[model samples]
Target: MSAPRNTAGHALVHGWKWLDGFASFFGAVVGGFYKIPGTRPIKTLLHGTWPLGHPLHPMITDLTIGGYTATVAVDVLYLITREPGVGHAADVLIVASFLTSLLSIVSGLTDWNSTYSEERRTGMLHGLLMVVASLGFIASIWLRVAGAEQRDLAIAVGIVAWLVLIVSSYFGGEMVFGYGTEVNRQAWATPPTKWERLDLSESSLDDRKPVVVKAKSGYPVFVVKLDGTVYAMGNTCTHAGGPLNEGKWVGGDRCEIECPWHASRFCVKDAKVHGGPATFSEVRFEVRAAEGRIEVRAR
Candidate 1:
């Protein structure tokens, strides 16, 4: 038992050692392909079509491939019975997965080009492994079609592909969690919750320019005035903590303020999102005029 345990532990360590070198080398090779100057423009163009107010490429790729991978085990079981209907169903799933894999590859390349150097390398490794796994699955599907008798071969290939995908998924998780890829970009925000009394007696606010004030909690808050009404929100932009007070205001009625860094816009009235690069809304505070002084409370 001790011998077996030692052997297993050694294998595990050696396995990871090999994986680390392989992933690093392959990541460097693939990352170089997307580092060309022309790739950035194309990737930026694709980013425009991404859904959910963030980069769309990653989301779509995950959905399409994740769905297909999830269904593969069940499909394999159905194929084992040699039922014509089951085979037909599996075929549809395979084709869908293949098409999605193609789409993922294209969008992933675009995203890969824009990533930071370290993240790009890690993302490249994840992408390369996924591509190999996807190709293997595709070939397995071809074999299955050629002869249903090759069902076990197809299942074996699928299992291998699934294992590869698991490894790729781990790397992908590292890209997001470790490297901050496609993350909320605004997860550490504190919402407006306290009422601050504005010293309106001071003449500095009369010009209607944005003013920064400290909340009771010592957090910086931005205040602006329009039509005798004062509005307040967190001074920090939800995306990357940009200063929102200096941002340009567009139009009236919950005037939209655009972040200078990433151009994320938010409404002054309720802090609702007006535009992208930021999915979360700003923190808004309710204000009341009292004896020529403006007092604010969290909404």
Candidate 2:
């Protein structure tokens, strides 16, 4: 019994290693296509509409998991009972899951590209594994629909596909838990309650140009004055900590500021995102004027 158990454990380990290697190889090939100069235009087009900052990955993952689980359960029952209706229903769900997985991959990659250097490699790995898992599930579904005489073979494929999905999920968990990927950077921030004076007695800030100022906590804050109203927000771009003070302001009243690095735009009034590559809003600070001096405080 001990010998058999040890053999099973070793086989599992070996299979996992092989799967990892295969995923890495294929991921590199796919990633190369995405890196091409011509692909940039396509990526930009897709990312422009994608909600990169709203935690789309988790939502996608949940949908994929639900669909896959339902498909697996239906497939298992179909195999055991030889029910064609159950198999047909499972086919529909499997196809839906595959399509969802493809969209998730696209959205995930869009966010991954702008991530910190420390997170890029591991995130690439996690995404690679998920792609492999998706492909396996697709193949399994194809084989099932092909009406193969040996139903057992289809059942075996489904089992393998589920195993791959499980492993890919584990890698994704590591990317979030260990590396803090997609976590809100401003979650721990405490905004100032009292408005601190802005030393803008000089005419330099009178033009309503954006300026960077240090708060009492020494954190950099971006300030802009429009129509006698002063607006302040965190100077750091929530996407990649790019200098928001240096970003270009577009249009009037809308207060849209676009990040120089990734072109992520945010509204000045509510700090809400107006464009892609940044899903989270900048931290907006409250401000007022007292005694001919401009003052701002965090909300």
Clashes of each: 2, 1
* lDDT to native, each model: 0.64, 0.68
Query: Which residue runs does candidate 1 get wrong by more than 4 Å?
Result: 1-62, 78-80, 98-124, 131-157, 179-188, 198-203, 206-208, 226-228, 249-254, 291-293
Q: How does each model score on TM-score?
A: 0.63, 0.75
Query: Global lDDT for candidate 2?
Result: 0.68
The candidate scoring highest on lDDT is 2
User: Candidate 2: misplaced stretches above 4 Å?
Assistant: 1-53, 148-150, 198-208, 227-229, 250-255
Query: Residues 1-299, candidate 1, lDDT per residue (tens digit)?
Result: 01122332233332343445554565465457546766534443444322344666666667766756765756676766757787667667777777777767766655454454445556667787888888788877887788878866876787688778778777666665566654554466554466567554333464346787766666677777755657777777654567888888764553778777656677776777665445556667887766667677767
Cα deviation at 281, candidate 1, in Å, is: 1.3
Which one wins on TM-score? 2
lDDT tens per residue, model 2, 78-143 = 878888888788888888988888777876776566554334555655676677777778778778
